[model samples]
Target chain A: MSKDSNIQIQINHKPTHLPYSMTLAQWVEHQTLELPVALILNNQFIPKGEWAQHLLTDGDHIDLLSPIQGG
Target chain B: MGPSAPDSWNLYDTPMTSRLWMGSSHFPNWNVFASACELAKPGFITLSLRRQTATGGQSYWKLIRSLDIPILPNTAGCFSAHEAIQLAEISRDTFETDWIKVEVIADEQSLHPEGPELIRACEVLIQKGFKVLPYCSDDLSICKALTDVGCRALMPLGAPIGTGLGLLNPFNLERLRYRFPKIPLILDAGLGKPSQATQVMEMGFDAVLLNTAISQSVNPAEMALAFLEAVSAGHRAFKAVPMPAQPNAQPSTPSMDMPIGDYRVGAELYGN
Candidate 1:
């Protein structure tokens, strides 16, 4: 892919442009995620073990969730 | 027997000495929350999930990891079984723990648990090997339905969430306990004071899950300690076997054992 090439995707419902052919693992490593997060790609959960193998393409929806305070 | 009698209960096959399960939210700061958790030493800590913000760098997982206690991830905001099931799966995957506090709210105003949806969720989650703890109302039929669906424990609310109303229907709780003596019933939500927690414990509830009562107090840590003491005291009092209630008053001293009085009244007594 050329340096100017970009892949548009939605993360947690926000649209963003990323480097083409970026794997889910790469996307995760690039972000400052608190450890032990669950990821969803296009409404389907991608387990932590498969992040390295799973690839994110254009127009994909990614959701990252972590534990917060609850009663 | 002394006050320090040993007692323990099990939830989903895990033995725990403390019956107080706490929530880690609404504290003045994380430091106060940490202090409260350390002091309270609850049997389980309840947590939830939300979207990670770009600026959200702080990790509650760090706090949870440091505690080394049993973590119960909740499906707090989910309104449907499907939504709750999805969150439960994600929570299980992320936390690597099968324990979940399932809250399927029916309405926005009351925040009451949707009984039928909760049963469906419990059925699915339990089939998937999740140790489900369904947060339900004090209604017996709903509780029975959850149990039928294989929920490990039932968390009946004492009042509306965050209202601090505290055990709106004690009779229902008592009836539930009496009917299902073996079920592990944890009074969850609506408790505003340590005394309310103690009262529920005294009524034979296996445990109590509290958050606002401790985290929202003037002194969170101190309130946590107070809850600990109150739970212990109430449990002890329950075990001590309080005297049963009676319709008529009974005198401590026996009339037959009293000293006999002289047959004739004294001159001064007669005059009076």
Candidate 2:
């Protein structure tokens, strides 16, 4: 966990390396996802209010869900 | 005069003018879906959530938003209460609506709702402040359980999902109608034709949720209008209170004042 150390995380089932540790909100803002998306961190829903406080860690599984056709 | 307008009904205390709830799936294209929606004017349209990709669902979401109808998201592929709960939570967050259609499938082939797990999921969702409309079977006991746990509406399937079998058990649906006269009963799934929708509406169902029947039709927009008119006609028929059937035939004309007179006079005249 050094200042310049990169952390690995999985987003939407795809693994990637972040330049440094960032809050969930920072990651979301960085990705510029469409409006009205839901976030699931480690199999649990992380509400928008907590996105700022929840920082990304190595090997974290993040799922971003958006609307689709359904019956 | 033309056909009378359908009376407004309430879903979880929200007054809805349309008795038809359209499912937003399986259309040939978004234009057809939009045309259908424009023609039908459903009170609500259902949608779901999936893992987001780079540009996935953005256009679909935009189109759905443009329609300006309320959304009722579903947990279509969930198998357990936990999965359903998680999905419901995400659905509520994504759609920004408390209304959810809870579906916990017990069998893959049949696509039937798991009664016990459905109830469990509904219970949790209700506790979480969701206006849960559980897609369940035509079982009275299960319906009662869902209502007892504070479900505002019950969506009992006529047959398995997408089968279009059309009310496989009318007896159970009738029983449910009689048993829960106060609750909003939406006939969801397994409807293939507009007449089937009319049949359930005539049977006193509050609404019909349709998807495959309209989406897979040769002309989805026309089919949407057909189902809309069918549902309206059924509602009108139910409200009109049809006359009871009789065991024997009853003459519609004035038999007493007939020029032929009584049977005895007729026999004398004709020399029977």
Could you give candidate 1's per-residue lDDT for residues B71-157 as a string of tens digits? 889999999999999999888988888999999999999999998888999999999999999999999999988888887689999
Q: Which of the CAPRI classes, incorrect, acceptable, medium or high, describes model 1?
A: medium
In model 1, the Cα lDDT at residue B179 comes to: 80
TM-score of chain A of each: 0.83, 0.85
Q: Model 1: number of clashes?
A: 1
| The best candidate in terms of TM-score | 2
What lDDT does each candidate get? 0.85, 0.90
Query: Candidate 1 clashing pairs?
Result: A68-B48
lDDT of 1 at B178: 89
**lDDT tens readout by residue for model 2, A1-71:** 23535689988889988887888888888877665788889988998878998989989999888888999
How many angstroms is residue A67 displaced in model 1 relative to the true structure, after the best TM-score fit?
1.9
DockQ of candidate 2 (2 decimals): 0.66
